[model samples]
Structure formats: structure tokens, C-alpha cells
Target: MSSTASTATSPLGSGAPPGTERRWLTLAVLSVSLLLVGLDTTVLNVALPTLVSELGASTSQLQWIVDSYLLMSGSLVLFCGALADRLGRKWVFMAGLALFTAASVAAAYAGSVTALVVARGAMGVGEALIMPATLAIIGHVFPQGAERTKAIGIWSAAVGVGTVIGPMVGGWLLSGFWWGSVFLINLPIGLAGLAAAAFLVPNSRAREARRLDWSGAMLSVAAVASVLWAVIEGPDRGWTSSAVLLSFAAGALLLGAFVTWQRRSAAPMLPLRIFRHRALAVGDVLILAGAFALIGTLFVVVQYLQFVLDYSAGQTGLRLGPAALALLVAGPLAGVLLPRVGLRTVAAAGLALLLASAAVLGTTSPGDGYGRVLTAMVLLGAGAGFVITSTSDAIVGSLPDRDLGVGSATNTASIQLGAATGVAVSGSLLSDHYRSALAADPHSSDLPPDLLSSAQESLGTALAVARHLPGEAGPTFADAARGAFVDGLGPAMTTGVGVTALGIVAALVFAPSRTASAPRDKDAS
Candidate 1:
């Protein structure tokens, strides 16, 4: 295609090009869809204890309930990105919205734990389709420049808003309704997104859409699923167990094969050549690190508030509100500064702040008041706002229009992978530490072995069993369990701090000092 043809505003089936007014309207619809996706990520964290109480779900089951959705979304996101480029972005997005809406209903009405898990997996597929398309569509509507950067910042903020709102909404719902109400809330939003998307969004695709590479897609999904399975199951099953070892080995082989196939394929789904760009590679890594810290912190801390500090879901959500407010305030400001200070400085500062927040949270004691923790959460939100917005701008700005779907998908996939790993790793460490703490507690020596075993299984179980025991012994046991749980947070959050600290170095070393310049669609090369 000629550079002029590439740059020119093309007619959308209607003979006229989209106007500026229409472009922003389209963004509004896309943002709504993004908000729903963000809400789903953390909504379930607040519902875990309820799930355990209501459904008799084990600790491993609870982790799966969270990880299953992430695993599917992360695995299929890139493939869906390629599919969007081949098909039309709007078509895939609408289909995904429909599927997600339906899955939400199924999840809300699920009869058993297994049923809920299946419903969550289906939701993941829908998210994979919706997540990448939103950003790719934004990239299409906004031409590369300050306008695009600002637009991306808004888009990034929409996602941040979703994550922050998830806990609040979930907590409020749980206070008055059943745990299933959290999933049900998505229905009305998804229906509205579908209607708005149909009229406002334009259909767009790559200039030379490549043939779908089925082999590469399958290999990628298998590799991601197997690896996530290993991570999710490793702590419970024992890392040295044959099942875990085999899963790791298989994931490695499949991933290697997927890479090799992409290298040799005539029409590749993922153009590996893109990684050569420092912005794309580094931006993706930073996103991964940010998500790891973000989700893992949510997973551990929600339990801390509920099980240890004895806060209700609503109280916990309200306590977290300041962090959301901080993120909302900082998100757009980061965009305004991008042109002046560049991505590296903004992103590095964000990572540093996140590392500091993690360290503060790590020192939290079971009896501590909410003040120090709330301060740490504010820092956490600020850091997330800067990193998420700046890195997103860098990733999207650096890509050509034709590679927008691929690039957007990769960024979204990195987030899902990090979320999955964060939950798995942090959950594993906490579980191990909690069990060890329970076994070592002097107060537990007189308790029956089976009772101690039940207590060691999970905080929810420990608390539940403590309620059945009579007298001072019950209170003492409960106190020890809460202490163990709080102690576990130290190592898990410390792990997050270590990961984010590395992201700080990466942003400084690999992210460019200036924003990447996108070639105008109307300009000739």
C-alpha cells in the first residue's frame, strides 16, 4: 500500500470518513467494555471466603476459581488478536461481549464449584476477544501524536478504574446479596456495551491480513495452560511431584515449538520481529511486573482484612477506596507529562513507588490500624497509574497500524500472564507459610491432629473450626491462625517488591527517553 493510502482516512462502508465527534464516542463505548473487564479481575478476591463457606470449595479450588479465568484469557489473547486482524475488530468484540454476558449469567446461577469454574473459563475466552480489540480500536481511531497519547492515557485509566472499582462493587454486592451477585452485575453493562459498540465502532483490519496459523495458535495455548497449571498446582501437589515436573517439561517443549514455528512460518500469527523494538519488549515486561504486584496484593490483602482483621466486605472495600481515588487522579496527569518527561522517567518513578508500597505493606501486623495500610495503598495506586498508562502509551505508540492488534494483544496477554502467575506464586507462598506456622504454634500441641490438619488447610477452615471449639482454647487458636496468615503476607509482598524493583531497572535501561513517533497515515515514507 502506498504511504498516502495508508495514512488517508478511509471510508467505513458509508462513503464518508469518521468525524472527530464519532471517534470519541467510539472510545466511550470501548471504555465501558474495558471497565467490565477490569471489574472481573479483582471482584472474586473479595468473594473467596464466601465461596468457601457456601460451596465447600477447598483452598486449591479457590485458587483455581481465580486462576482458571486468567489462564484461558492469557492463553487465547494473542490468538484472538491475530483473529481480530484477520476478521474485523468490531465483529470479534461484539461476539465476545455477548459470550461474556451469557457466561456471567451462567456463573451467577452455577449449581456447584465445577460449574462455576467452567463458567469462569468461558468468561476468559470472551475477555481475550474484548481486551485486545478495545486498545487496537483506539489505536485505529486516534492517529499517532499527542492526541493518540492522550487517548491511550484515557483508555489506560479506564482499565485502572475497573480494577479499583471491582473490589468496591464486589464488596457492596456481597454485603446485601449472595456471592453470585458479583458475576450478575456484568450482564447489564455487557448488554449496553454491545448496543453502543454496534452503532459507534467502525470495522477495521490489517492491510494484508495473514492466514490464521492454527498450529502456532494451538501450541501457544497449550504452552500457556500447561505452564499455568504447573504454577497453580505446584504448591499443593509438591513441586517435585511427577505431575508438576511433567507439566513444566511439557510447557517448555510446547513454548519452544511455538517459537520455532513462528520463526519458520511463512505467515506468522505473532510477528516476532516486533520484539526487536526496545519499547515493545520493555513495555510488555513492565506491564507484566505491574500486574503481578497489583493482582497478588489484592489476592493476599483481601483475605487479610476479612480473616485476620475481621473486617466485612464493605468495610474492606471502603478502606481501599483511597487507592482508587489516587489512581484516578494520577492516570491522566501521567499522560499530560509523557511528552515533557518521556516514558522512562514516569514509568521508573511508578515502579519505584510500587516497590516502596509493597515494602510498607510487608511490615503490616495483624492488629495494626488501617492508617498505615491505607497510605501504602495510595502509593500503590499512584504507581499503577503511572506505569500502566505510560507503558501502554509506549507499546501502542511504537506499533504500526497493521500490527496494532498483535501489539495490543501482547500487552493484554502479558497482564493476564502476570495476574495468573502472581496469584499462583503468592497464594502458594502464603499457603506454605500458613501451614508451617500452624504446625509450629505451641498452643496447637494439645489439639487433635486431625483438627490441626483442618486448620492448616486454610484460614477460612481454621476460623470455621475455631467457632465450633468452646472456651479460651478457641480464642487462642484463632489468634495464632490470624498471626500465621499475617506473617505469610510478608514473604508474598516481598516477592512482589523484588519483581517491581527489577521493573524499575528495566524501564531505565530499555524504555526510550522520548515517546516513539508514529508515521502519519496520510504521509508518504
Candidate 2:
């Protein structure tokens, strides 16, 4: 169970260890893949307003544009991971990269909201294939211990780099080109990654062949899709609507079935017994919470800066620089500290920072300048960096050698599901609040019925309508819309505060005090 024993027994250990340079080069290539995945996560955020104007997308439709990719990627990753274990990691990864590149072109040229959403979902399929393989490869290339931890830290930082770069790049593209330009940017990056992967990346898989769990895969995909559908549609459909209620019911039942199937299956996609490791279980939960808060806040804040504060997309992306910078510094630092300190201490501190970030952001108002928001963004980024890096290490470190593929998939799935849910839940709260506030505003009384209906759809729609209104009425209506958006931002961020607080509690109660010296058995229970 020690690092020495793990390395000696590993399937990859049969040959001479890869040279230091080759290992690092392989990591760089894999990092590029992660960078692309991370970039897509937020690139669309700054483009949401543009999509509304160009495609006539409603609030729910915009959420779908974002969540569609996440839902598919999150749901299918487990299957892809198992397939990688059965087939070959390198082949699956290359195939995924090609598919993702093709999907990017489709997304870029999409003419309708539905087309874009579907294209994004296709991209997610490729993403599901790429993500787990990246991490699982790292597990094979680097032995367990400090080396592996450092590799993962750097690999994880690529995602942070991508997260920050996405908006800046997208904003710059939007300044001169059409909204589709954002998706187009991925074409060259994907191609370059494919080339690098072909030559530089090494192929590895589980030594033992396992049967694929088709039923479990189906149940998970349906459950997650149903839940996301309900959450995204609830605001517009009314929470009590039969469709929303039925979707939620179906999701719950499917989830229960999935658990039962996993428990009984001969070769399970995810071994339920792995959760017996306190560190692994708690780490997964914290990662989910961290992503939920981080992605959810970004979803709303980008809109707030552009709509309420009247910043251009480029300017808004620039303002987000502080968070990115903070994350860049915090991620590697967390990795260094994990061995010296302990998981509970590091994770709790990170969650506390997140809690503070959410509290500060929750107090933001339209009149407030960027200073308060800047402070919160920095905290959010740093908190996320520490939490994600440390927790990712914990998850990868706790798993036995054979579970690396599925375990890595589990980690990635938590992130995708968290991000998807964050967008759905936070967007829903924002829409509900925005609609309520706009309806109550005195400006609503003056608008004609048709115009009022359009305005109530979203802040972007309202502002578009205001542009055509006569003189002062135009300015007044726009101001009212901005105010409503700010009102919605408060509740969305407050929910983040609550989630982070719970994460803090969970970390303190369940996370291991120190990193284990050896990996736990997969069948620990």
C-alpha cells in the first residue's frame, strides 16, 4: 500500500520508468486537453447576452446552451472511463479529441438556439472521453507520492488557466467577430492537441478486462438529464407544474435504480464500496460544492458586470482577472501544503474563504463599484484552487491502482454535474427573482402588454426593448431591468454562501486529518 509497493506492483511498472522529460512532456499535452475543456466551461458566460440578441434565446434556453454539454459529459463519463479501461486510453482520448474538434465547428456555425445546444451536447460527449483519460494517464505516468501530487497540481492549474483565459479570448473575439467566433477558437487548439497526443501521449489501460455495465450507464444519464431538465425549466414552468414534478420524480427513481444496479452488478461502473473511504467520499462532496459555487457565481457575475454595471464584455473579462490570478497562485501552493499540513485543515480553510467570498458577493448592489466585487472574486478563485487541488489529490490518492480510471471519471463527473447544476439552480433563482422584481416595478405599468411580456423574459430582452422606446422611457426601462438583475444576483450568491458553509462543515467532520501514507483498498468496506 506504500508508494514503493504501489509503483512496483502497477501494470505500468513492468518496463523502465519513463524519462523525466518524457513524463513532463506528456503532462503538458494532457494539460492542453484540460485547458480546452476548462475554457468551454466559462467562454459562453460572457456571450450569453449576445446569444439572447442573436438567437432570441430565453433565460431557460441560455441555461440549456450551457448545461447541455455538462449534463451529457457528466452522465456518460463513467461509461467512457470503463471503456478506456477495456479498450485503450490513448485511442479513446484521440477519438474524443477529433469528435470535439468537429463538434466545435458545428457549434460555431449553428444557426438556431436548438442547434447550438445540440452541438454543445455533442462536444460534451468528446469531453467525457477526454477528461478521465487525462487524469488516469497522469496516474500511470507518475508514481504515488509527491511526484504524482505535483503533476496533478500542474494539470489542475491548466483548468484554472483555461477558466480565466476563456472570457478574455471570447470577449476579444466578440469585439470584432460574431458570437460564433468563440466556438471557432477551439478548432485550432483541438487540432494541435490531437497532434501532440498522437506522438507524445502514452497509452495504458486496466490490466484486467471488465464487462461494461450498459444498464448502469443508461440509468445515470437519464437520472442526471431529468434532474437538470426539471431545475432549468422550473422557473418558467412553475415549480408546481406537472412536468417539473414528474421530471424530478423520474430522476429520483432512476437514481435509486442506478444505485441498486451498481450494488448488484458483476462489474460495476462505480463500486459503491469505495465511498467507505472517508477521505474519498468527503473529497468528492467538497469538489462538487466548490464547483457549484464557483461556476454558479461566474454564470451570474459575468451578466451582472455586463448588464448592471454597463461594462463591455472585454472589460468584464478583464475585471475577472483578479480571480484567475488568485487561482493561479493558490492551486500549486495548495499542492505543496497538503503534505506539510493536512486535508481537514487545508480544506476547511478553503471552504471558509469560499463562504466569505459568497457573503461579500451576496451584498453587491448596482451602485457599488468594482472594489467589493474584486475582493470577492479573488477569494472565490483562491478558495476554489485550494479546495479543488487538495480534494482532487485526496480522491486520486485514496483509490487503489485499478480504480484510477473510474475514480478519475468520478472526480470529473462531480465537477461536470456540479457545474451543470450550478447553472441550472442559480440561473433559475436569478430568472425567478428578475421576473418578480421587473413585474413589480412601476415601469411595467407603462409598457404595453406585448412589450411587458418580452421585457419580463430576461434582462437582455428588456434592454433590447428599451432601446426602441421613446427618450427617457428607454433609459428608465433599462435602469429598471438592471435593478431587477441586481436583485436576482443577491439571492443567487446567498445560496452560494449556504453551500460553502455546508462544505466547511462537511470538511471538518469527514475529511481526514492528514493524508494517508498509502492508498485504501477498493473493497475497504
lDDT of 2: 0.85
| Tens digits of lDDT, candidate 2, 1-525 | 233443464454533233223678899998988888899988989999899899999999999999999998999998888888777778889888899889999999999999999999999999999988888778767777888899989877888668766777778878888999999988999999999999988777776746899898999999999999999999899999999999999999999999999999999888887787677789889888888888888888888888878788888888888888888998899999999887887888888887788788778887897898799889988998888888888888887756777888888898889889888998999999999999999988889989988988889999999999998999999999998988888888888888888999998988898867444222100
Tell me the TM-score of model 1.
0.95
* Candidate 2 off by > 4 Å: 1-21, 517-525
lDDT of each: 0.85, 0.85
In model 1, the Cα lDDT at residue 511 comes to 86
Clashing pairs in 1: 7-521, 7-522
lDDT of 1: 0.85
Count of clashes in candidate 2: 0
